[model samples]
Target: MSLKSLGAKIFAKIVFNRIQKWATNPVETQQKVFEKLISEAKNTVLGKDHDFENITSFEDFAAKVPIRDYEELKPYVERVVSGEENILWPGKPLYFAKTSGTTSGAKYIPLTKESMPHHIEAARNAILCYIKETGKADFVDGKMIFLQGSPEMQEKNGIKVGRLSGIVAHYVPAYLQKNRLPSWETNCIEDWETKVDAIVEETKNENMSVISGIPSWVQMYFERLQKSSGKKVGDLFKNFNLFIYGGVNFEPYRAKFENLIGRKVDSIELFPASEGFFAFQDSQKEKGMLLLLNSGIFYEFVEATTFFDKNPKRLTIGEVEIGVNYVMIISTNAGLWAYNLGDTVQFTSTKPYRVIVSGRIKHFISAFGEHVIGKEVEEAMNKAISKFNFSITEFTVAPQITPSEENLPYHEWLVEFDNSPENLQKIAEFLDLEMQQQNSYYFDLIEGKVLQPLKITSLKKDSFQEFMKSEGKLGGQNKVPRLSNDRKIAVALIQIQPQN
Candidate 1:
């Protein structure tokens, strides 16, 4: 190993040891974090509004501060946006991470000085954990590139504002700056297509060892690289061994990525949002991400099934169980109190409190009482793909409630395939079988003839891309939802182009 790699290995050992402390004392660490968040923010606007001074226990905190999504939390966020000090946290934030919201248009999430370290450190330690486990830090000597939003900033009330990825681009640790690829000018190109073109030109011949981004966007870059160099991405960047991704489930895209790169690379999964960086895949052999209990965020879990019910019970770290799907609610140092981030997660390992993002609370199909989640569908899709060795570019599922009188209503799958399967009906049957195996309710629905086997509609090439482009979200952090309860996205896809 080189001097740098040796140094990284030593540093990785230190971080790994530190992380082990909380792995054993997960609940205790979280309780301490909870107390700190409450005590520190007791004087802030949200803290005062929620009677934080009187809050003593988790139950008290839950009772006083009701879980609020972006819309409910908007009034206070607006105050902070208008240059109000101590509105959420102790003072005005250092940055506002501008993100596209669902109910509200654009959400400006705070990034306080106190909270920023978690985001940065969690990501760093994830790599350190890998280095410690595998004894592979040679990638540190080579080029690294992150496919992300522009680094350009727009000021909002004296506070800097940009996409979270864009804001993070400005803070690439000093050590990695030398190894980081894609020049500042290339990253600053705002238009997605133009920026990608610039990135391809700049990094095509570079010694790239690490490539990180959302899967779909990175696929585009890989394709572009392949086209330009007439070689698989793996061949071009032979040293490229680490793939880091966040935002969406990577299982469905794994096959396509494997084909693009011509080989498999070790991957690290991250659970990060504008609110906070919650978890990261710490062990190569582990099933789920190791939740950051000692981070500035205090987490709560409401069972996803009862999330919409009147007064859903919130569970603390000690109260959680393995395999239970929960809507992850968080109160963070960023001053987001009892915030519902919309993402639903399942606890895979309670010992260290590891979680897998199952789906979004607002994004599931329950039209026929056979509630289907994103994780189930993605797993079923992967199963079917693996069985058939088929090439799927992108796909989504929605309920076909009103079908022709001849057929029962079913789940409609719109698939964009890189290489269309010869036996579409067989693949559909396989997908349906896998889905039934995964979800018992779906099994009942199929057995009772409440719904027919899922129907697959092969979409024209680039259908998903066209839909995203039409929605003004062709690139950056934007992603097509894997499953939608409604036909909004399906209808929009239909309007965009032809389907088979």
Candidate 2:
């Protein structure tokens, strides 16, 4: 084995030991983490303002600090953006990760020198934990390509600003750089399509063993590689075994990915955001991801069913129960206190603190009191795809609140297909039925004549591409909303060259 592989295995063993200790008693681990994080930041401007010095417990912290979103925290973020030192963190931030906003305008999230290690360490531990669990280290000896956004950064008030992928690019360790593909120069290409082509040319014949990126962009790269090599991805790189993906769920695209690769490979899911790296798939034996208890972020959960209540019950890690959907909140080393990150998840296992992403707080359809979320939509789509043997390149669903004066309001799916199904109507009917099976409220609405059967608007080829391009959101961590509460996006989608 190579020296690097041996060192990596040694590191994995050490990290796995720590993971075992942390997972032994999640409640205690989280309590200690919260105390440490709070004590470290209690002297910062935000901490001082919130009386963190006097806060003695989780309940005290929650009572002192109100749950806030980006808008509520905009003033502090703006201060940091304008070169204010020690406003949020101890000093000027190392960088700011610009979030691609759909509803609110783009947000600039601080990444401190202290917090940067959390992102790096969590990522390292994710891979290392996987190796320790599966007893595989050969993948580390070969090249791994990260299909990420442009690493090129811009300065804002002398503080660097870019996407999270760009920041991560700047921090790739020297040892791994030798086995990483696609030169740094190529990674700087601003246009995604052009950059993807460059990446295909650069890594087509390399000894690639692992590939990581958001599923959709990586799929584009794979397609280009297949056309150029005239071979399936598995044939092109027999060693390619691990796929690390985040930013979106991979289930809907799993079949298509396997079809392109000509085989199934081990994959790991990550719950990472601009705010923090929250969790990762730790064991193939378990169903959901294991939350990182010792990471620099302290977590809280507010029941999603009562998220908007004036005084919603806030629960700590000790209080969380399996099967309850919760809106995740965090107080991190980056000076965010009780900040709501807008993602929702449900605990599948509380003993070791494992969870599955349920949906985003903003991405839900409830036009007729039958609320449906991303998880339900993804499951229904996966079922339809599996049974129908079709492929979806991209899709989004929105409530058709006013179908017509005579027609009852219903859901409309705007889908872009790589391989169109034999009968689009049948697929649509199947999805509708699947959704009904998932949500009884939706089923009742349909049966009570309050809602019409779901409708399908098979989008013209490249319709999503045109829409994203027109909006200047065509690439780099931007994704179409899987579900929306209103028809604003759906109406605009229909105008984007509908096939029908």
Candidate 3:
């Protein structure tokens, strides 16, 4: 390693030591640390500015600031794109992280100097914690492949502006910069259309040890690797040690990933967004325990019960409870306050603050006027599949509304399975029964004649790839959207005939 790499290593060690000290502290101490950080943040943002005087306490700051979504930040984003000083931050944003949103077409989220350090810290803490648990840090020494977005810059009037991935690549530690498997500048081949081909070509020869990306993209890459080599993916990346994923849950694709790799790969979950890296799986031993970056952003949880009742109570980190779901709200250093991030999560424990991602607040089905969340669907499916002694490779549940007299909505399950089971009907019935048991709203709708019975379609193993390709969203950060709850999108997707 170079001198810069050595310095980074030393810095990482010091940071890791501090995090360990914090992790072992009492809840009271941790809370006090967070309280002080909140106070400092409030002072930093509101102190120098005349317009921000009303923001005195954290509660006052939250109450006074109107919640903002990505759309409201678009004008500031445009300013960053033009390299102008934006209202949200003091200086010009260092880079823009391009990401797509459900309603917003494509967003360019600003990553100011103040915000970048948080991302680095979150990433480092995650790494350090993984090492602490596994007693292995050199596992990353080999060729580590990241199925990242293309770093090609977009042009405005023939002048090239840097892409989000390019900016991240540029800013990473110089040691890491040297050891990056595919040189970002050269590896990220231009044109979104050719991304898969480029990725496959670049990774063919390397002894890739660790891989990171969204689950869907990694699955697609594995499939392509198998097809090209005429061998299983395990044969391709024989030296692979770990799999780090984010952007979506790995439940649906778990079996496929294990089967492809021929080993139980160590995995890490990241709750990263275009705006910031919010949370990460701190310990490898704990699957979904999210360690919140206490110093990065202040978090608030809207009580799940109140939300369903149409009256929500927002609670801070100090007030969160175990096993209760909540909508995530965040106030970040980058000028967003009490912003509803639209994701839902449930705390599994609060002593160290562990959480399981429940679903997106907007991505739940309200067919028959009774709401059902993505977590419910996942639970029902998992229980049902376990009962059948067969594992599901991939699946999606779409709510279909009938055009007949009743005009009722019914669920259609599209599943991909490894085994061609003799009793498919039994599996279907079990899944249907489990759904009713798990989601009372679903049961009530069916019993009241407001919704019809569940339907199942066994998809060919390669069907998801074809669907993704047809949509021009083949690889990198894209996933097969589970529980397409919206009436129109669900209808359109279910109506598509499976390719022969």
Candidate 4:
């Protein structure tokens, strides 16, 4: 091993022990975070508006500050955007993470000086934890590609604004600068397809070992690399061993990824967002990402089933239970107080608080009362694909309330296959059976004749990529929604279909 690799090994062990203190004292760590956030922001406008000076406990904070998503909190954000100080956090925010929103056009999420370290450190620790557990730090000596957005930033008011990935690109550690691949000019390519072409040209012969990105976009890169070099990714980058990803569940794409790489690589999962870094895979043996309790955020859980009720009960870490799906709410050092993050999670291990991202609260098919979620569909499809030895490029689930035929409403899965299966009929039945087994409401609906078994609609290859490009969200943090309540995305997909 090189000197750098040996140093990383030593650093990994030290970091592991430091983080273990917080993991063991989850409740106490969260309490300390809560107190620090309240104390620090008590004089700010949002804090004053919510009477934070008098707040002494989680109950007091909850009662004083109602939960608000980006849209609801935009008034304060707008003030900050227009150069106001102490509107959200203490003074002016260091930067704004610009991301596309659904109902709201573009969202500008603040990243404060106090909060930025949480995002950077958690990512670093994910690698450290992996190295410490598996005792494999040799990848540190080889080329690493993050497969991120353009690092070029545009000034919004006085703050630098860009995609979160792009903003983070500016912070690559000095040590890894030599090992990081794809020259800066290539990374700045505005167009994703053009960027991938540039990346292939630059790194096709490099000793790449670690690759990180959203699975959908990274798949595009792998396909391009294979097309150009006529070699599987594993052969092209023989040293490549670690795959890191977040934003979407990797299970659905596992088979396709293994085929592209021609081998299985050790992987680490992360649960991060524009607001804060929440969790990361700490142990190779663990099923869920270890929740960052001592990070600069205080977490709350509202039961997903009752989230829409007039008044949903918000529970802290002490009150959360294993296996119960909850909409994750967070109050962060970045000045977001009781913010509803729109994501749902299930605690797989509450001892040290490990969670799996279950689904998005707003991203589900509840057209009927079946209320099928992202996790259920991904799990059901994963099983069916594994059983049939089939692999898919991309897929999404939406309710088809108005079928072309006189049939009952059903969930329509638009799938883009890596290789078309010969027995699609059998695969459909298997997928439907798996879905029925997982969801009781869906099973009851099917038995009551209110809904038919799920149907698969095969899409032309690269349909999702084409869709994302047309929508101006081809790469970076953008991802196709896995589940939708309505047929908006489904209708859009139909329009993009090629005519014979």
Candidate 5:
């Protein structure tokens, strides 16, 4: 083994030894973490404003600090951006993760010096933990292509500001830099379409052993590389063995990915957002990600069903139950206190505090009161894919209201196919049937003629990618919403569809 690979294996062994016990007793681990975070932040301006000194326990903390969204926290964040020190954390944050805000225009999430290591550590522990469980570490010896956002950071009030991926790219450890692909100059290109081409050219002939990115973007890169090299991914990169993805559900795109790779490789899912890196798939044996309880963040959950209510019940890790969706509430060392990140997740295991991201609390389609969500759409899509044996490259759903007396209201689907079954109508029917099975309200609407069966708009290939490119949202953690109550996204998709 080369020195770098040998070093990686040794470090992985150390991380595994450190995090193994914490995963077994996550609840206890989180409690201590929560108390420590409070103590760390209790002297800051935000803590002083909220009287954090008097808060002694989780219940006390919850009672003192009201749950806040971006709008509510904007003032404090702005102050930090304007060079205020000790306003949130002990000092000004090192950087801000500017997110593509669906609800608010663009949100700047703080990343303090104290919390930066947590972000790095959580990601490192994920890979290390996976290596420990699977005993696969030689991939570290070959090149790893990390498809990330542009590294061209912008300055705001003397602090660096950029996408979380871009910011994290700067911190990739020096030891692994030798085997990393796509030179830094190429990564600094702001335009994704341009950047992807540069990435493809730089790494096409390299011995890539690991690849990581959001699935859809990675799929695009895979297609480009395959087309250019005229080889399946497995053929192009013989040593490729690990795939790490996050930012969207991977199930709907799994079949397409498997087809492109031409072989099965180990995969890991992570739950990293601009807010924080919360969890990662620790073992191939389990479906859920082991929550990072010892990280510099404290987590709480409110039953998603009751999330909009005034003063909903906030449950700690110890109180969360399996199978119930909960809106995540987080207190982080990055200076956010009891902030609602708007993500909904369901616990799969309470003992180790493992969870599966269900959907976004803001991203649901209830235009006609049927209350369809991302999870339901994903389930229906999964079922249809299983029943029909077809593959989807990308898809999004929106409500199409009746245009007057002539047209009928229906659900509109804009789907880009990697491999389509011959009978499009049969596939559409199966999808509608699965939606009805998953949601009775939707079934009742269709049965009562309140809504027509979902209309399938088969997009010509590359339409989705073009749409994102045109919208300047083409790469790195950006995702097409799975369900929207309005036809804005659907109309845009159609407008950008490739002309036959």
Candidate 6:
């Protein structure tokens, strides 16, 4: 290993050791660490601007600031892009991370030097914690294949501007820079259609140990590899060690991957975005634990019960409870104060802050006025599939409303399964029953004939990956949207009638 890699390895070891000690301590110790970090962040803000000096405690800080969404920051982003200093921060942000907004087309989120460190540190700490928990650091001798978005810089008006992906890739430790599979500068995000093919070609011969990306893209790559090599995914990735996936749900794709690889690959969920690398899989055994980047951003959780209310109550890490969903709000070092990221999560446990992503606030189905979020659908589906002793390989749900007088709305399930179809109808009946049990509103609407029956389409084994690839969203960071509420789009693509 080169000097920088050796230094990074040593630094990682020290950090991992410290985290291990911290992990074993009482819950109060972790809270104290969070408290100290919150105080430091408050102090830093106060020192930079006199306006923030009035902030006293975490609660005070949260109460005094109003929650902000991405739309509210557009003007400030525009000003920064125009080369203005001190609009959002003291200086121009290092680079803008390009992200797709659910409603808006695309957004360039600015990440300053102060903010970039947080992203880097969160990712590093996640890796270190994983290594500490699993004791598999020594096994990572082969190249770490981050099936990441392209690192191409976008040019506007004769000026070449780097996106956050490009910027982060540019700043990666110099030692491991040469070892990166695709040359950073050549991997263009705008050219994903072409780059994905190149990515498969480039990594075909390399001994890849750790493969990290969104489950959708990885699934696509696996499918392509299977076809191109005329071999199963197990043959192509026989030497692969661990699979670290993020950006979307992996539960649906889990069985297919495991079966294809012929080995139980160690998997972890990463809660990261273009904005910043936030929480990650803190422990392999526990459901995704939220390791608060104490140094990066101060976090607040709005109680799920009161999130839609005008005066919702916000809770800190200490005040949060298990089994309750909350909307995450953060005040980051990047100058975004009390920003609502639109995602929803539920805490599985509080001591270590284990959270499972519930769904995005905007990404829900309200067809026939029966509100259904991603989590509820997933749970219902899980229950239904478990009854048949068969596992779901991949699935997506879309709301469907027939044009009849009832104007009813129901769900269309596009599912891929590995087992025999002898009990397919039984599976559908169980799914419908589970939906009725979980969602009262859905039951009422369906019984009243205001909603149609739930429909299921059993795909041709490995067709979901093909469908995603055809859309040109076939790599890291992108995933098959689990739920689409829009009626027009749903009708055009997915077949509503249940297959025999």
Candidate 3 TM-score versus the reference: 0.85
Candidate 4: segments with Cα more than 4 A from true spot = none
User: Could you give candidate 1's per-residue lDDT for residues 295-382 as a string of tens digits?
Assistant: 8999999999899899999999899999888999999999999999999999899878899999998889999998899999999888
Q: Write the per-residue lDDT of candidate 4 for residues 1-500, one digit (tens) a residue.
A: 88988999999999999998989998899999999999999999988999989999898988899989999999999999999999888999889999888787999999999989889899999999999999999999999999898889888789989878888888889988999988899999999999999999999999999999999989999999999999999999999999999999999899999999999999999888899999999999989999999888999999999999988999999999999989999999898888999999999998889999999999998888988899999998889888999899999989999887698989999998887888988998998888888889999999999999888888888889888888998988888999899888887787788877
Clashes of each: 0, 0, 0, 0, 0, 1
Candidate 2 overall lDDT versus native? 0.87
In the order shown, the candidates' Cα RMSDs to the true structure are 1.1, 1.7, 4.1, 0.9, 1.9, 4.4
lDDT of 6 by residue, 1-500 (tens): 54544555677678877665644553455356445434444444322443355555655656666677889767666766777666655556677777666667777777777778867676667777677667666435566667776666775433335545566666666555655666554476456556666777777777766777777667667766666777666567566877877777777667668766767878778887766676788788888656563545667789765788998887776778787778888766565667788888888876656788888876778766777778888887767655666766577788766545765556888777776467777777778878888888888887887777687867666466556555555554666667778754355345433456
lDDT of each: 0.92, 0.87, 0.67, 0.91, 0.87, 0.68
Comparing 2 with 4 on TM-score, the higher-scoring candidate is 4
Q: TM-score of each candidate? A: 0.98, 0.96, 0.85, 0.99, 0.95, 0.84
Model 4: lowest-lDDT 10 consecutive positions:
491-500
User: On a 0 to 1 TM-score scale, where does candidate 1 land against the true structure?
Assistant: 0.98
Candidate 4: the clashing residue pairs are: none
Clashing residue pairs found in predicted model 1: none
2 or 3: which has the higher TM-score?
2
Q: For residues 1-500, could you state the per-residue lDDT of candidate 3 as single tens digits? A: 54543444565577667865655553554356445445444443332332344555556645555555677656655655675553455555566666666676766666666777877767667766676666566655667777766766665322244545455555566656545666665457654346666667777777777788888777777767777777666678787777888877777667668777777778888887756677788776664655554555667788755765534566777788876778887766565556677788988766567788888887777756657777887887767656666666567777776656655667877776776567877877777777788778878887888777786777666566667767766665666667766555344444565556
Candidate 2 deviant stretches above 4 angstroms: 102-104, 498-500
Report RMSD for candidate 4.
Answer: 0.9
What's the CA RMSD of model 3 in angstroms?
Answer: 4.1
Clashing pairs in 3: none
* Model 5, residue 190: C-alpha shift (Å): 1.3
